[model samples]
Target: MAKLPNGLISFGKNANCTLELCPLEASILQYQPSIPGNGAIIGLFALSMLIHIIQGVRWRSWDFMICMVIGCVDEIIGYVGRIMLHSNPFSFAAFVIQVVCITTAPVFFCSAIYVMLSRTINYLDRSLSHFNPKFFVWFFIPIDIVSLILQAAGGALSATQSGSGNKLGVRISMAGLILQVVTLVIFVALFIDYVVRYVRKSTARPLQSRMKLFLSFLFLSIVFVLVRCIYRIDELRDGYDGPLIRNEPLFMVLEAAMMVIAVFCLNVGHPGIVFDREPRNDAEMSYTYTGNTGAMLQPKLPSSSSE
Candidate 1:
């Protein structure tokens, strides 16, 4: 077995030392990564990139497509970073690439979600929501930005530090994760409320199949993201040496798999369902139905008398 450079510790127990400096006795999690897992993630992200491009062109969903494209690219880069780590655990470039890209990628996904939800609100009925559809875009996206900034800064700080770990970075990253959770929770609540209101108030109307599909998938994606965020919060609460942070299987399931599913769900339940509408006369305006029925309510117009 090869030994690391002098004065460096391979295990995370001594953070000041580079990972390559550790002895063969070091835990696998500290210096050895799963090549297959990282490879799979990279491939999946590439597939997602292609899929998003096709969907974007097919549906003309420019904003959604842009976000997904950025997200998939980030995931690809991050996983490539992981691959680099697998080859040489002491590689600082790999650490920074994985930490920064993966940490901030989801913010773009959240941006797409915000944009889609606002459009959904408009398509259904602007009056059904408490605030303007744009309000969701404006309000939540900014919060997402703040979270991204904090997480990126924290990841950079933690990655650059030597030995013993950076307490400030861990705390800041934890704060970012917690803030993300709070933001998602609030967004979900508002989204659900809007849906309920739309359903109840538009009881006479029937929902389009596309709209129903969009809603179902969108809701599932939200749940998946929330679960992932919660897992990250737990992982970070323990900081660098936390059990959750070092658990490879848990990270694979909670982080990689969760995000993959969420993105795919969005692709399947795309916002194109609502946005791909054709202009119709007033008598044929679109109005979504309430409850389990897939019926459309006819437009009501006053009678005209002829001489």
Candidate 2:
């Protein structure tokens, strides 16, 4: 039996061992992942992906639809890894798949949310925003890419090593998770600021009921994702063998349930629902500013000539 520097047995791809041959504690996770729980999560994500595909095509929201579908697919694959882990807790391939896919899936989700904010800002009043609407896409998307790279690299590194070498990979992954949390915090702050400014500076009519509902659900989705990111950071803080990582129930609640709610919330608040309406003609779209009052005449169609 080969042992690594960390005093744990080296169970790499070639390690010939079974649950009966070795103690359960010898496995990296020390327990089999729950098949039923992972399968349920996969089903939910698949359903969300299907709905997104339909909505995106119908509304012509190509970018949002693509991002969401990819994220859901990534999530499904990650959970499938967990299901594989249930059959063999020491499976290195399963560990790598789950770690990399699950860690990076939210980056896609965040990118989708970032684009929505940019679109929302433009739809409302771009002038009220502190930065250009395109800035959100250009800046945040690159940051998300960086986070994804770091997490994927870390997972790869961990899969290739055994024992104490795993700590370095965990640290790198933690850095990525921390960056994600910081990014979310900044994004939420900017979103709040934009909303406040829009409320104060615009003289437009109050938001319609549907728009109000859309905004509410969108914000809730961000909050749920933020909560999940925070939980992941804490879970990885103590490394792979940490207590939190070993706690399957907590993972189900914080990671799985949080993501489930976040995705469903996006479905309810789909941007296309509000932004895909028929465009008004130029005559009905004209605006006349009321000087210094921050007000403008609402656009309306011209009256009939006979009248």
Best-fitting candidate, scored by lDDT? 2
Give per-residue CA lDDT, model 1, range 23-126, as digits (tens). Answer: 42343246456899989988887887798899788867777889889988988899888888777665667777887888878878888887766776765667
lDDT of 2 by residue, 112-230 (tens): 88877777676667778888888887889899989988888887776677667778888888888888889888888998898888777646545656667778998999999999999
The alpha-carbon RMSD values of the candidates against the true structure, listed in the order shown, are: 6.1, 5.5
lDDT for residue 81 in candidate 2, whole number 0-100? 96
The residue ranges of model 2 lying beyond 4 angstroms of the native Cα positions read 1-10, 278-307
Report the C-alpha displacement of residue 23, candidate 2, in angstroms: 1.7
lDDT of each: 0.74, 0.80
